[model samples]
Structure formats: C-alpha cells, structure tokens
Target: MCDDGLMTSPTHRAIALLSLFSVAQCWSGAALADRLGVSPRTIRRDVNRLRDMGFPIEAEQGPEGGYRLRTGGDHYLAVLDDAQSVSVAVALLQAAAGAPVTSTADSLRAIETLRHLLPSSVLSSVKSVHAASGTVDVGWNVPPDTRLIAELAAACNRKVRVRFRYCDSRGRVSSRDVEPLRILTTGNAWYCVSFDLNRQALRSFRLDRITELTVTTFRAERRDLPDPVRYLQQNLTETPRWPVWARVRYLAPLEMIVGEVPRLYGSCRSAEDGTTEVTAGAEDWDALAGHLALIAIKLGVTMQPISPPEFSDALVRIGRRITSFGAP
Candidate 1:
C-alpha cells in the first residue's frame, strides 16, 4: 500500500517524483514518500525507474541531502497533461492566424514543434477546433516593417539602444537614437515606447513610421515612467489640436458608441447620468459634423454639438442635404 493506503501505479509515482524534483530542486526520500503517499522504499524504487528511462536523478546522503535532477548528456522531453497539450495546440493555431508579420516565421516554427510533440489524436482535435474558429481582420492602418519590428523587440528585451529614422505626421523625417523600452498595440497600430537618448526624454514612435532601425551595443539606462499600457493610452488617445475641434454630448452610454469610432478620432468621458461626452478634432467643421452624424445614427441616439457654431451649421447642412435628396 502507498503512504495514503491506495495502490499507486509505478508510472504515476515516477512522474510525480519527476515533477516534485523539477519544482523543488531537491527532496529527501522521506519528504518524497510523504508527498506521494508512499514509503521511502517506494520512493527509491521510483527513482530507479526514472533513472532507467535516462532521467539524471542524482542522490546524496545526510540531513541536507536529497535527490536532484542534474544536467546530463541526454535531453529531457516535456511531459504535458491533456489540458496542457490542448492549450498549447490552441495557442499555436491562434498565433498562426494573427501573429504579426515579423513573428510569422517564429509562429510557424512553434506550430511545427507542437505538431511533432502532440499525439495524433490531440493534433486532430486541435485541427478541428482551429477550423471551427473564426477571426475578423480589419487590417492595420499602416503595416509595420516586419524585420524592423522583430529587431526592435529583441533589442528591447536585451536592454539595448537602437537608432532609427522616423517620419512624423507632417512628413518631416529625422534620425533618432533611443533606448528601446516597450512595444504597445492600440487602435490597429504598434508603437514603440522608448527613452530618446538624444533628446533625453520619453517618446513614442509608431512602428509603421520607423525606418533604418539599428540596434546598438550600448545597454539602455532604465527610466522612471508610467506603465507601458497606460502611457500609450494617454499619448495615443490625446485629441489632436485641429483648428475645427468640437465637443458633442451624446444621450447614450459611452460603451454603446466606443466601438463604432476610432480612439484616435476622439476622447470620450462618461457622466453619472449615463450620457457620454466626446471631444473630437478635425480639419474642418464639415468633417467633424459628418462624424457626429454618423455616431448619432450608429448609436440611435440624439447628440447635441457643444462647440463652435460651425459644427451646428454643418449638421443643419447635412439635414438639408437629406431633405433635398430626390426632390424635384
């Protein structure tokens, strides 16, 4: 009988011992026996079984001594449970579908690795699950250079400095050297948040607008900055100071209309009365009014323009256009 008074299979006991040693680093025979609900003698027998299968389990004597898995000439194959296998398979499929262009090769490699590792039955089930799943691809506003993104990502992970040419919205191109920090994805675009070494300030560079990316040998100096996601949210969502900016208050909740509009187009605030205030900027009143009308129509709610009179006039013009349509 095992320590818990139940018959334990040798396979189960060996796997348990392997897991325990992997996690705890070392475990005495008595501790292993207690954990597995077996005797010290059974633990020894299980260790021997693992050794026979080429596991490098080393044993030592004394109070501080126990069995430990040591580095050996042989490689260790992962022993995954059913759930783990399924999870890995599912992840591989998803990555194959939606991973960035830069990561496509790596994703494919991972998928192939999982395909070889998983059993035939599990692979078939994973395939079935993948075939049934669907995703909508709205496409990126600007496709980033895959190789540049991959290099920058690696540089960020390694705390390295990188130099790159950047083009601003106004078409002004400049060279910049920055300490790679974090990469952020928002509103169908990727931005690299980095500390600009030349400017000595924090900056966000759109991956799509980056060029001539070169990783430097110099390690980056850490900076005190807000969380990567939060910083990106604040910078990315700031309304542009266009000449014809307008604020509109909508009767519906913010959540009802958020998905219908792009975050770059406006900033929204919710009120206690379930109403939403949207502040958007555009080059002209007509453009702003058209967006407002679209939002009102999409949400099926009334919106009151609370800005420049030109916006209200634009709405009137839209109404006139609608009323005059198909008229003699």
Candidate 2:
C-alpha cells in the first residue's frame, strides 16, 4: 500500500482492461473517482466521454442512486499521451499485420497507445525491433475482460469501492467487497491485490473470472494502503510454486545467477558453511525443471523446505524428470 507508486504504464491492453470494469456499474461519481484514483472531476469526464461515445448511462434521481452504463457502445478505450499515439499506431499495425482478423484491432490499439505516450527518444530501438520482426505477426489473446479491468483500475486509483464475484484457487465463488490496491500480471494471469474487508485481510484476486466489476461507494470511500507489485510478488501466484523454491550453494559467486533468475531467495553467506546460499520461487513444480538443469553447472542445489509434503514431492519430481531427460 505504499502510495500506489508511479509504475510506468505497461501496454494499452493492460490499461484498457483496468479501466473497463466501471462501464455499467451503479455508483456515485465521487465514489467512482476514488476507485480510479483520480479526482471526482475525472470520473465525471469519463462518464461524459462514455455518454458521448453513445453508451446508455442512466443517471438516478437522488444522491443514493448513481450513474450506470446502459449498454452497446462502440467506444473501445483510449489512454494516450499524444507522442505515444503516433508511434503506437505504427507499431500496432506492424504487430497485427498477420493476426487473425479478430484480435488485430485490440492489439493495434495497445501499440498505438505506447507510441502516443512515449517521447521521441523513448524507444530508440523501435526501428530495430520492428525491422527484425519484418512481416512476423504475433497472435495474441486479448482478455475478454478488458473493459471491466480498465474500469476497475480507474476505481482502484480513485479509491472507490468495486463489487465483483471472485473465483479462488479451490474454485469456490463469492461476492467481494474490495478496496483494490494494485493490478499485477506476472504469470500469464492478471491479479488485483486488495483489502478484503469481509475477510479482513489483504488478498490477491484473479482478473479473468472477476465477473461484473461495478463501482460501489459503500466501502470505497475509506482509504486503503496497498502496494500492488510487492503484494502480488508476495501473493496472487498460481497455487504454490515449489519449483520456484531453490536452495543453491555456490562456490563461485551469487552474482552469476542474479540476472538469470528471480532473486526470491536473497544470497547470503552461509551461517556455518563458507558457501553462498540462494533461492527463488516460480509458478509450479514444472518450472523447477529449468532451475534444476542449472545445477549441472557444478553448483550444489536443493529445494527449500515448505511445510507441505506436496511441495517437497514437487521439487523431487522436478529433479527426477530433468535427470531422466539427461539434462546437461
């Protein structure tokens, strides 16, 4: 919850997704702004923009009732800085040049926004990447929940409450009253770190199944302290990443593998032994295969212990699998 620090904008796809959740929700403008981490005026402006784009936003009569989306608008989403738009447009066109006709538009928009937001010197190597990929077209899956994600981001930044149904790891479903902290997209999945007032704890919720994200004023007015990236790296990971857990004793040095892997386990001089110990956490047992292969480099390695038999089994299995493959 550290001040929702200024992390640079990722892709337009990410932004579009974060902002689209509030489209058809019933909530006050003030409350909406809080959820989006912007001034109330910005919420009004967003509402106006949606309305201008032909969305059917119904305004309620009294203060209790709030504005909501009606339906069927042609507008996608746009958050560009001008310099970014031009460059993005070109890059997107190039990226989507051969995609199936369906995802081309959304992919194109993401590139366009990047170009619009960046300064001229921002991507000195843009031409190089573009040239290398010449006619190479990247097929991508644009999440079906982009609009809702976009709106949710806006709501989170604005400190407004958001309502959505959550599907957890065990596949249990429940309605959530969340004060969104930050959005994390680490493992081919998107996560929202938030204060689950009901649970009275910080939790990471996935974005894919966060159905119907509508703005809520009931609890959003209260301030929440959340640092999304740290929270995500700490939580919201897929199941438990046992393969990600590594304990390696290196005679050479820790700096060698520092860039090669996530430094989940800080390197330290062993308490009794004179070797350096290092560890990392990944997504699953399957991921450990790669890390274990690095053990062939003459470094003594083992999986760090977690309190679960399954986690231990996972690591051993990974080792056996790589060894079976004659990993060198």
Candidate 3:
C-alpha cells in the first residue's frame, strides 16, 4: 500500500505545490509540508521535480528560508487547475457559437489546444457540458465588432464616458455621449446599458447598431439606478398601457418556458396546478395570436386564451392554418 501511494501521490502533490507557489510570493518547506500533509524532505523532492520541468523555482537559505516561482517565471508557462480549464473550455465553446467566421476559427483552435492539455477525466466533463449546452441565435447573423466590444468593456471597467454614433431601428442617426455602465447579452445580441448624458436617463444600446465608439478620458459620475440585469428585463417586457394585451395559460411548468421565450414577447408566471401563465401585449389581435401560436409551438403545450374574444377568434384562425398544412 505504501509503495502504491508513493507512485500515485507525487503528481497530485506536484500540482498542489505549483498552485501554492503561483498564489503566494514564498512558502517555507515546513509550511508546504504542513499544507500538503507531507514531510519537509518530500516537499524538497517535489520542488526539485518542478525545477526539472523548467518552472524556475527558487530557494533561499536563512531564518526565512523558503521557495518561490522566480520573477519572469510567468513567461515560461501557464498552468490551470481543473476548474479553470473547464471554465476556459466552456467559454471558448460559447464564444465559438456567437463569434463571426474568423473569430470562430480562432476560438476553435484555442478549444482544441485546451482539449489537448486538459486531463482525460476533465476533458470528458468539458465535453459533456459542451454537448448539453446550446446557444440560441435569435436570427442575429452579424457578430458585434470584437474591438468595439472590448473598448466598451474597458470603459465600463474604468467607469468612463464614451461617445458613439448610433442608428436607431427607424434609420435615424445621431451622435451620443453616455456613461458606459454594463454590457449585457440576451441570446446572441449584446446591449450596452448606459446613462445617456443628453437625455438624463438610462438607455440600452444594441452593440451592432453602434459605430465610431470613442472612450473619453472623462470619468463617469455614478448614478443610483436599478440593477443592470433587472433594468434590462423590465425594459424588455414593458409594454404600452393602451396596447391590446392577452392572457394565456399553458399546461407547463414555469421553468419549462421561462428563458426559452424572449422577455420582449411576454412575462411568464407560475399558476395553479403547475401551469404557466403568460401575459403579452401586441399591436392587434392578429399579432397577439401569432405570438401565442409561436409560443405554443416552442413550448409544445396547449394554450387556453384567458381574455379578449378577438384574440381567441384569431387563435382559431391560426389553428385553421395549422390544419390546412395537412389538407389536400
């Protein structure tokens, strides 16, 4: 048993020693031995092994005698724990899903490199995550400019103001300056949550619609606003008070349809007997019926319209269309 343990334990001990050295400036032999539950002699042997691998581990002799990864050792190699490796792999997969053609190629190459380096056990878990997870395109074909996204992220991190030329959905163009607060991703689209300086209100700008982004030297004044994620969700679901709204109940659980449907379409809530109720607004009965039909198809559940007879009639018309597909 002792001989078997000796053979299998050195690799894990070496990895733990490296992790400790990476995080701290120095660790004494006694301290490392105590931490790894090994003798000072074993710690010395592991340190020597790490040095043999070109880790640039340094030792000093004195009352404060210890070991450390030498200065510039970071330039030699990078090491990742299991969790960090899995994080990188999952992030690369997500990036590849939404990235443009060229960026996707680079992300794939990095993922392949990670797979080659990660342990077989960890690589299996990473592959499972990749297999179970998926990205919804939401019909966005053009990926946001990576440079612009990076600049906006930096400005947000620094709490700075940025100026950009924006074209709204109606084809109106304007130059605006704003304090970049947060960048949010809903599906494949990216939106910048900002405090518009000119309008003196919070605004969400779609990244693809923004151009000529310039991060200014001016610092941003913090404002008391709702949490960025909650604010975005509210803005996405908020509808005009006077619009035609319909309430429908689905024979499905709230978790089943929560994120699958965009918040812009409606708000979902749990109902009695494990059903979900969706309240959505539309320009007219036809539009509302169409939305409900699409939601039903996506959820694979029967929907019972709760209000507005016009909406029920419109839903019947949609049902006819579905039946016509099978007709001669």
Best by lDDT: 3
**Cα-based TM-score, every candidate:** 0.53, 0.43, 0.51
RMSD of each: 13.3, 18.0, 11.8
Predicted candidate 3 versus true structure: per-residue lDDT over 212-290, tens digit per residue: 8899999999689877767666666674432587888888899987775556666789997899988887667887898
How many clashes in each candidate? 2, 49, 0
Every candidate's lDDT:
0.68, 0.50, 0.71
lDDT string for model 1 (1-328, tens) is 2345332788656645654554566788888888889888988888888777656678988889999776423333346544555555445444544677634444545544444445564555444333332222322455434345456666777788999899986678999999877755442456788888888887888888888788889988767877665666666567363567788899998888777666666778898889998888776778889888888987689998888788899999988888899799
- Model 2 vs. true fold: TM: 0.43
Poorest stretch of ten by lDDT in candidate 2: 1-10
